[model samples]
Target chain A: MGELRRDPVRNRWVVIDPERPDREAALKVEAQPPPPLSGPCPLCPGNEAMTPPEIIAFGESSRQRNQTDWSVRVTPDLQPLCRIEGDFDRRPEGPFDVMNALGAHEIVIESPQHLLTWAEFPEQQLERVLRTYRMRSLDLRLDGRFRSLIVVKNNADAAGILRHPHSHVLALPFIPYGIEEELRGCREFYARKERCAFCDIILHERVSRVRRVVETDFFVVLAPFASRFPFETWLLPLRHASDFGKIGEKELVDLASLVKRTMQMVGKVLGNPSCTIVLHSTPFDEPHTHDYHWHLEIIPKTAPVAAFGWGARLFVNPIPPEEAAALMAQQM
Target chain B: MGELRRDPVRNRWVVIDPERPDREAALKVEAQPPPPLSGPCPLCPGNEAMTPPEIIAFGESSRQRNQTDWSVRVTPDLQPLCRIEGDFDRRPEGPFDVMNALGAHEIVIESPQHLLTWAEFPEQQLERVLRTYRMRSLDLRLDGRFRSLIVVKNNADAAGILRHPHSHVLALPFIPYGIEEELRGCREFYARKERCAFCDIILHERVSRVRRVVETDFFVVLAPFASRFPFETWLLPLRHASDFGKIGEKELVDLASLVKRTMQMVGKVLGNPSCTIVLHSTPFDEPHTHDYHWHLEIIPKTAPVAAFGWGARLFVNPIPPEEAAALMAQQM
Candidate 1:
């Protein structure tokens, strides 16, 4: 098990997962030329034995475990950042607070094949992937020990060592500082205007249309007004949905289409740069409040994050959001 | 001039500096075979005209400006993220807050010989570099238009495009979110303990000595209790100082030696990996208070920051700080 330590001054928690494989060694493994496409891939079909026992698989039969028939499969992380079996065991070491990194680290294999990229997946397959996300989020919340579920996809080698199309689901024991801030901001906005902050953004973006890139019947894609990175875009549902697990089949399909199209546009413009797509939703155990709105954010890895960004937490984006939206809109 | 836009949801400001030269183009330029070390090095001797007119230079005579005799020189950024000439014309754009990115961006040329890394510099030369930082910081705060001065060094190609040994001084009209959080955290700790949070940390680290990597007469280098990155070390002054600009000659020399030694240890352990050194101090307009303590944070670029860190503002440091400190202390 790993430990979560809080910075004495910043008051933010850092997950110090010593159990995580050596990062340098992981990079070395990734730097080596990948094996041929037909080679053994743990996430691919017929290689299910290479991974841990499957927790769930969306296939013709739920009875069949760790088989090649599944379109989307969920399994435990080979080297989990945090173990699911341990108690939080919160304690203080001297002046710092420490706790067991108790939660679930699972991988959601997006497809059965060795398809390397998510953007190339068909819309139906992508919808199944999104559905699997909803299912796992809903399933993980039943464990009272979990406070938040973070769903993220490291799309390419630039993002991480994972070349296979997969997304991660981390059931965290506490609300991350970033999500807490967003929730606080939303609640504050609600206290003032009795409206969701994200809903207001959607209304404002739709009215302005300058920052809007593309929209489906249920979702809207636009560049964030204060994008931290170039080509940073958000996919927000038109409906006021706080929990991603509450997404209906129609909304999930629409979301899949919107995500696929937006990603394709980003790839076309940025020349298929590596990117990270994260799903941000209301924390588990939180009430169905009207203040919060869930969304997906896609950040293309266009440039290295230098000291200025890391030090100040103030990002200097060379591309204006309006210009980025317009550029993507042109492709749409 | 650039614009600063506020993320209404996250309540953080982002600098959209369109005038910044395209980063891709800059990388392309750097990718080309470098010119000879002595050939037309902009930061070297006889190249004073290559940069913008020197704002200040320290050498044999202080009166000489833009001359090759200067051991250390300060000049305006050729492509500044924010310009000093403009007023921060604040306004509201629908649901967002906006202002002109009005501030100062300057570069401190560390050496006249085009030394690429600060780690190789002698103790005396490093002390002069530290002195230049204090002088420029004090000078910039006198303008009254700036709220914070962020001094950072991007050491080596991995950190940035600048190949010459130099650091950046960015004077911003508003406090960055990162600094704001640290100040808030310190204030909260002070409210509870009636003592400076960092001072308490210094006492604790000294007493425990587990995370302490190096201890000099005036400063202590230790891996922070909740380091966000591997081999992340902080250099804290023994005396209570809210501002870096207040350092005296003795403290400056001591800090220089401490920083050099810490960097050497890090380089030795990490094999000279590119790193970033950031100076965190009190805001310019804030009065001297016990609620803030200045320090230097060095983050080695051992691994790429993936989606989890970017989206959640939660860092998953693979190496435990205790282990990291022990590794560095082996060399120290």
Candidate 2:
């Protein structure tokens, strides 16, 4: 007789089953050994010849297009979600919305080794990764076809997936509605207050120090007051920056350190947890988005969003963000 | 390397985890042995004595404070996400937005039996279940505090942690932003054409006879052209009705038959697959939503959404709705 229920926050619905059993049994039965690596692993340095021609790479001193002595590599996705072809379709059939998949999707191999995690990369290597992301984003924006460029990292094991470490970058032709709403919300607040909403948030968190997860010279990681998910945290730059791809060279080192340190802290706190990290940037096609500040969101896989959360679009946040931040602060 | 990507249409992100070893798993696990019924199953008939007094019920029902003999029951949630208490404290404390949790959350016991699915119930019993939903919704709207009422059902193994079947109902004080966006989008379309958007969609599907998953006297289920997820289908009425709770008795019987028959069709087509079913109704607090028709969304758990899909709020639908409907039509 376990009944279904709806949460109002996100207007999503979930069915509440009254007979929940222990969840650990499934994990126990599925902890099989890792699959053997056969053939060429494109991420491995020696396998460079096996992948699409490198788009960008980092060598001993400066940027390198293609050289064996590389520390990091970036290449076009083998199976891209969006191809670099097609005449940006703008036709609409009655009420149905239609658009062309005009964008660039690329993959960044963080390390030459198959086993090294993105966080395990040295500071220099991490800085190189950031450089590649920025360079790619800048180049894509020049096409005027892409509205925005997004950078994301998918770490398995924490996100209920296989254990692997890599990140991705995508340039899109349209600014998503959700992100647009966020930008609008921020812009409205800024217009009224004469200051950046996120900057104000950072200042408040600095003073309260209640929800600060980790702090670096360039950035501070904290949990949002109204987190949509449990253990949801964010990394915001201390300085007010509209675009992630435009960070100063000096700030790049600090950003890299902050990112690496945060990932390590996450590994320590969640035990090498599987998680998703996303870098939200300004829509390139929309130059008037100065009100939107770029940031990164990291969601740990400690609690999977159930039907109640998904169906209703309402978050049943068991662990409040403030409390979660306190836990992370202690570990950091 | 696994990377995150965003889908264009639904504006959601998906993660392609290069690290995950399990690319494809079981679509839906078989139901495990029912949990021992000793823990006071919150949804059982006697459980009425455990939850808040019933709001509505059928079948030899007794109005006594904690009596049983009920086939379907509705009760206040033991632990509600939004409480029906105190004024909504809406204030901006500097940059942070805070509000008191205000609303009503309740559960719908679909069946008196612990193991029986709503689909397995007889046509009359299913009608009774739907009647309970509509009656309770109408009654809840009488309370001026609620802005909207949502009814949701999660069935099968893919959508549940507990093996038992159940549904949920919520009376929200706030008109959710997501639903508001849809209304705004539809209203804008209506303003231009002076016609209901959903009605036009219905006519299109009716004429094309493609993407129609199931049709009934009062209800027609179809896969939307711009589906957010794979196998994401909608159960809409043939008539242009805006309010589901306002449905008459005759329509209720037809809707019940439609829902039950549709679930059976789904089971037959997908091998008794699990799915989430959500009902959308008109807002009680906001008027002029009469132009918006109420419908139910049934999304089968086919694939895991990646970071690009979840993070960027984009979606990548691999299966076209028309194709999916054709598959289901064959099974039916």
Candidate 3:
């Protein structure tokens, strides 16, 4: 089991998972050329036995759990950073605070084929994948120990050796610092103007139109005015919603389309650079927060984050949001 | 010129420096092997004309500025992200805050001999480099527009094309979020215990000794309890100090040795991996804070910062600090 340790000075928690795969070993594996697409991928349909028992699967009714017919499958991570069976066991160690790593880590396998990414999946298959994300999020929230859940995809080379099309759904015991900061900002904004900050952003972007990349019927993809990375974008619903789990079936279909289209555009623009797509929603334990707005942040890893960024929480993005938006819009 | 933009949701500022060299161009330069030690290195002794005029130099008093006899030199960055001569035209665009990027960016050339690193420098030369850092920091603080100063070094391959043995001294108009978080946490800790959090950490580490890598007469280097990266170490003075610029001459010499020793140990253990070393001190504008203690954080870039870290502000460090400390100590 791993443990969560707090930095006394910064008061930030980090998961120290000794059980996680060795970094050097992972790097060595990544250094080799990726296996062939039709190679024995564990996430492929016939290799269901290579993975742990499926927690949930979406496919034909005649097929059994972890069967070939499944289009999407959710399973516990083989080497989870946080285990589901531990008590938090929070305690003090001198000046520092620590606790048992008590949460859930699951993988949402998006395709039955050896496809490399979700963007390459068909519309119907991608819709099932998005629906699976919502279903798993709602299911994980039922666990009282979990306070927050994040759906994140580490696609292509950036994800290391795990090349199959999948996203990770992490149930954390506490709201992460990033989300907490956003929530606090949103609450403050709401207290002052009685409006969600994200909602205000949507309205402002709609009027400005300079940073808007694409506007769909239900979602809008835009380059954030203060994007930390070049070509960084956000996908948000036009209608305000706080929890991803509460998204309607119709909204899920729209979200799937928007996500796929946005990713395709990103790939086209950046020559298929490795990226991280993360869904930010209200914490599972805090469903009643009206100020919070759910959204997806797509960050293309085009450059290395150097000292200036790592040391000072300050980023130097060469590309302006307006220019990035224009370039992305041109791709369409 | 660059502009600073603030993220409305997370309330973090980023410098959008369009004038800075493109990352791809820099990557191309870095892809080539490092220039030979005797090559026409701009930072080397005879090639002083190749770089900007020297702001300060430490060598034979008979030598003229930008001449060959300097052991240590300070010069303005050829391409600075922030310019020194500008008013911070702070304004609001909708809900977002924007300001002119106004600051001083200088490079502290560690040696005239094209030796690639400070670790290989003699103690006396390294001491001069440390003193130069203090002198430049004190000089920059005299400007009232500057609020914070960060002395950072990006060593080895991952730091980018600038392979010369040097450190960056940036004087910023705003205190970065990373420092602000530490200050806030420190203030909160002092409010409750009426003691500096860093002081408590030193005392605790002294007693525990599990995460202590090296302890000297004036400084102690230890792996942080919640280190975000593997083999991350922090060097702090034994006594509480709020400013790096205020270090005594003897303490500067001691810091120089400790820093070199720690870096050497890190290299021996990690096989000369790329790394970043950053100094965190009190903000220049408000210098009377008792809670904030100055320290140097050395982060060895052992692995890629993947999506989970970027999205959640949560880190999954595979190596625990205790284990990392032990490994580093063995190398020493």
Candidate 4:
């Protein structure tokens, strides 16, 4: 039998079960081998009939057919948290708690080629991928039932189950509690300081320079001062933009170049690390009156959360962000 | 190169570095069989002289003593994050933040037998372990320089590098920013409700009984509505209590027994899965009047933070806590 341990520092709890006998063996059970690069993945172009119907598709000039000439595609997820066909039963279970999984979940096929990533593509093709995300966001926001629309790109084999590089966009009927907490935090800071917390953080990091991992014309990537994990980094817009959809064509081009550069930098240092890129934008239908700043975060898997860390809700990082940044910078 | 991905929900950043790989690999590389139950294991009872001098010890009496007769022991960590000897340097150098790792780190060797946990121990033995933790907390509180004192137990191999079933205690000179945020949240709730938020939550969970995982004479375990991971459970006192240091002797025995039962239940269901337990308590020298509720969080090692989760700080759990509680209830 395992013991339950408490982290006195963070006041978090973790269960310590030693019964596995081979604690490391648990890793192998989920250690899915990398998928083969070759062959016809249904997500690949010309395999349009193989997948669910495309919600939106961008193809080469003079192309009318659905799958054959598409550059970027959007379709309903085969397995979705929120079914598209449901009546959205918002039946009440109790007071202070409402229930229903009401939302739209879709997958964005970033490229026609199965093997290539947005970064791996030429600049023009990548721009079209960006365009598809913005177009979807605009369409999703019109529903009014959704309190928020989020677009996330979980790239690489380590970050996602499927090897093909793609992104997810979700339209939720309710504003998630976590996002509300963040908004509250940001609102409090902005009200007191009369400045955006993220902007202040950006300026602080730029001045400090020690935590920076990558930088480009429109954005700067750096590790946070109070990083929750080792080697965790975020990409923030240099300008205070509340909406990702509001980013112009020039900025999108710049973002594409920077994404490639940042990914290249990380790949060099960590060797095709598993990572996620999230678009933290303002909630839908609401006027941009709060201090929320849009950004993206990338995490490379480096250390496993051990029992103490898991139990305590406190993370003990062996490497500091400054050390991580300095190491990555040297590689660059 | 791994491109940054975004989560459409909670917008927290994660890193996906593939270079370091898994900690399981590290264990294999060491090829260390679990240490023989016999011989000079520093944590074992008879090997008292093998470890650093005792900070606190029990059994035969609460008074400090020579090594041989002790049943429970506490000592300064041989390798500590905050060493006993260090300069308190808080300065910044050319864009780099620097500070001395000023804090107290120690280990509590739970049993002299080296084979039993608090759950496995007799009532009298478990009571003593709780008493020692209280004494240490009070003593550490007097250090005016420190901001918070956190005590934790990392039992399984997944909890830490060392496989020993031991717990740790740390006192930091700085109150971490994360803790500060939580404090603010707790206070805000209290100010509005004129009651502790945790107290209200406990009452709510007890009445609902929907998310409750376990109940004992002294404790009740449940899952938070906004659980970030599957099977994330919290064990709390049935009655309102601000600090672990203040639990009475009768309550201590009950709590220990409860912990044992909980562990066994978890083992039956998850095959003694690797988990973490964290203890949350009031910071040293702080007023007990704060609307804080000290509790323990137990997190099971269910899955890794994939790109979307890591990138966006949003978690998409396939299983809900209500469903998870039902599964756990079966084991009970």
Candidate 5:
């Protein structure tokens, strides 16, 4: 089993899972000319055997488990970050904290066809992908050990593990520092102003219009005021909500449309830049802080920033959110 | 003037400076095949006029200021992350915090020869580079606008802006969340153990010897137990200290040698991987936390992990630190 180790100097944990797939092997695909984009992939319909058996799938035609006809499929990651079967035993090893790397990591294969990304997906297929995300998020919460889940998609341009279009459904056994700090930021703002910080942001961006890329009935896609990367964006729900699993069907439909359209708009501007899109929500076991709002952060990966970011935690973004928003909005 | 904005959802700040080379223009050099190493480099001694005028330099036989005989040089970054000419004004903008992107940023040119990396530098040259780092750090503190200073070097392999071996001296107007958390982690551990957390880590690792890469009278080069990346290393001073600007002359020389040797050993194993090396210390104007120890975090930038990390704050390192330590240890 892989181990979860706590950082000695910071409130952080890393999943050290050499057995899952060594970094060398995990990234070996990149060494070769990517085998052509729409070629045989492990997540493709016929290659069901390559990945773990399907946990769920969404399509109008009812297909049996592990069938080829499904539009979107969910399967256990072949190289999971943390294994599902383990005792979440945490103990102190001298001065460091160590634990069993226990969690559920599943891949939500978005489309059977590798050619279509979120930007190119049919509206119905995009809705199904979003619906499947929520379904798996709720399903993973049933696991007693997990506390938080993030639905994450690293674009093909980002050199993700697979060329196939998919998002990872990672149910972590503990809340991450990012989640903790976000919650604290919200609670602190609410304690002072008696209002949700995200809600206030929606209000401010709506008035300013400079950072607002698209404002729909249910969702507003805005470039964050303090964007860490060029063309970074956020999909925020106008209606106050902390849990993604609790989103209404009508709202989900609007969110799906807005998300697809926003990505397309951003694509037109950046020529389809690689992006890491993470949908963050409240932890499963904790009592929900009303001020905490679910959000999707779309960070476009510009080259060499990561190397710079590692050394200095202070982010230095070149393109201001206002400029990024204006550039993206012009695509509309 | 550039602007600094606080993240709406996290206790984080970003310096958004479009004027200091927008991301597109900042990366234009990458679009073309890089100029041949040691070919018309700006940081070269003869090209002193190409960069901001020399702030300092070191060599046994010193030439006049901005002359061509220096082993190492210091100059203001032609495109600094934050400018030194701004008033550090901070205010809340609705729900978000806004501030002037005010600070001093300088480049520590480690070698005049572009082809000479730290692993290839002469022993004396390496010592001069380290000495230059300490000198610039103490000099930057004379400014009243900055609260924290980080002496950081991103290796040439890391796709740093300049091919010349250089370190960035970034003095921030506020203590970063990373510095804050590190101080807190040390304080909490001290509250219980009444011993410095880093000291205990040193004691524990020395007893184990598995993660120790090298140890000298003044310092220990270690692969941290919870390394966020493969072969992530740290250089810690054995003697108790919480500030990098306060290191003595002999200790600095010893640190330089150990740093050089450790990198060479790591180079032999990883085939010269790109790395971001950051020297973290106590924040200026803050009382030193007794349990906090100054250290250097050397993160080797493995490809594509940054993409995955952007989505999942919980790091998944395929290589365990123990195995990583053993790999580097074998090279020695």
Candidate 6:
């Protein structure tokens, strides 16, 4: 396993994975439909031996693991960002901090079939996907070494190298910088207002409804007020919950329907642009139950990353959130 | 004009430029060599009328404004991320905070000719470029509405839509989040150790010299200890300086030479990869004089922005800085 290094003078961590494959492989994914796979499609049902042995799979009650009959499956990432084993050994390298890249990286195959986009994923299938996500989150968090975990889905021609619809579960030894910022901000806001910052935003957005894109029984999907990208949509649960592992099945079903519809709208209005779906839950070990609210963000990759704001980490969106919401309404 | 919006629960700010031009044009830059200039090259000598009126230029003693005789020039961005006018208005849109995109965005034409890359810039011409950055920075600071400014240069074939060798000057009404974080880190370190964080980094780096790529009279260019990307280089001033505008004429000459040589190495080793050159100067009107040190960071566009870290604000580097340094040394 490689190691993680802390920026000497900044609050950022970087994982130096010398074993990363020629990342150029992902870029070629679009051009090579089968993704330059060795034999048959590794993700497809019959190619069970192709990928690392399945970690978990949901299929017929009569069937065994790694079967073609499976609906959803999870496996160790062939190109893991962080390895599965290590003592999160942190030592000082001169004046800088360094630690082993200890945690888990797994692939959540949303479907065993090719050509199925999230927009086309059935509500039942998406619900299964969410369950798989929660299962992996819970399982990974059980490891005392991991501090944070995320379920990230990349769906775009540019970024979606794998034609087979899927997501990735990344468990890290520490909470990421952005999450730490939000945790700090929410903690301070709660200290002052005695309410969760996300709950306040949900209430405000519901009342204003300017950037609201969709709302279900248990979730409210909205274009965030300060969207970093055009058509940037977010899904926040109506209830105040910090941990994703605590999500109930009924809530997951509601979320799955809302996600399916939201993705369909995104595809219809935005021509199915490349986008990222990120699940931000409370860190594994943190129990700031009332101060933080878990949420999901869907960011359309509408702009290049090499813009002027790259250095500053500020984003420049070509369109405002209200207008984006209106665009979604038009398509709806 | 566009406006800046703060993320409701986080510290990040984003610009919503409704009038932004076709950003995809930059993607097409590599395909269009002269970059599809409508008429004559805008930055070239005689066609200076094509761009927004020139702000400053340096050339022959007898030359007039916006003349073909200039060696280097500066102009307001034709399509700025933030407008040059407007009061720095801050208001609440429901539960979120926002302000007008009040700032100056100028283009610094590094060379008169379109074909000259920074690596090919003559030392004298590059010095003129640095002088132009300082002049505009100082001029923009006088506005009092601006809080921080960065001199940014994008020279990748993928991002360099304007074929002319140039950089940008962005002055914002607030310090960007990255700069703010650095300032906070530096201040906290100073409080604890009574030493400038960057000064200690410079000392540690010089003593180890493991990641040092080049050193000159006034600058040491090194692969930062925890580089976010492979070959992500930082050029730190040898002297403890907190403000970029305070750089003297002699130091400017040394910096120019170092910059030129470093760019040459980056070009040779990285195959003229697209990269961002950012100057992190002290924010205007703030004087944490002893705690901070201004520096420049050069990040290679080796990875896409839509990576998983896009959500976490963490970074995953494929290679370690030591190996990256070795690669640089091999080329040198």
| Candidate models: Cα lDDT each | 0.74, 0.67, 0.74, 0.63, 0.71, 0.73
TM-score of chain B of each: 0.86, 0.86, 0.87, 0.81, 0.85, 0.87
TM-score of 3: 0.88
Model 5 misplaced regions, further than 4 Å? A1-39, A60-62, B1-39, B59-62
Candidate 1 Cα errors over 4 Å, as ranges: A1-39, B1-39
lDDT of each residue in A192-213, candidate 6, tens digit only: 8899888888898899988888
* Chain A TM-score, structure 1: 0.86
For candidate 5, the per-residue lDDT at A130 reads: 86
Which structure is stronger by TM-score: 1 or 2? 1
Q: Which wins on lDDT, candidate 2 or candidate 6?
A: 6
Model 5: lDDT to the true structure: 0.71
Please give, for residues A1-332, the per-residue lDDT of candidate 3 as tens digits: 22222221122322222232221221111222455554567887888998889999988889887678887899997656567885667667786766667678799988876645656778888898888888888888998988899887876754355787888888887777777767776787777878888888899998999999999888899987776666779999999999989899888888888888887787777767777888899997777367988999898777554357775675565666777788788878
Chain A vs. true chain A, TM-score per model, equals 0.86, 0.84, 0.87, 0.83, 0.86, 0.87
Q: Which candidate achieves the best DockQ against the true structure?
A: 2
Among residues 3 or more apart in sequence or in different chains, the pairs in candidate 5 whose N, CA or C atoms overlap within 3 Å are none
Q: Per-residue CA lDDT of candidate 4, range A105-169, in tens? A: 79888876666654467777777877887888788888877877777776565434456667888
lDDT of 1: 0.74
Candidate 4 regions with alpha-carbon error over 4 angstroms: A1-40, A61-66, A83-95, A117-119, A174-182, A204-208, A285-290, A305-315, B1-40, B46-50, B61-69, B84-99, B113-125, B174-182, B285-290, B305-307
Q: Per-residue alpha-carbon lDDT of model 6 for B83-156, expressed as tens digits?
A: 77655466665656556666787899888777777888889998999998888878888988888889888874
Error of 2 at B293 (Å): 1.6
Candidate 4 local lDDT, B220-327, one digit each (tens): 988765565556777888888878777777777777777776766655555555556667777666744558877776766555533344433445554456666776
Model 2 interface RMSD over true interface Cα atoms: 8.5
lDDT of 2 by residue, B220-250 (tens): 8898767666567788888888788889899
Report how far off residue B329 is in candidate 3 (Å).
1.6
Is candidate 3 or 5 superior in DockQ? 3
Candidate number with the higher lDDT (2 or 4): 2
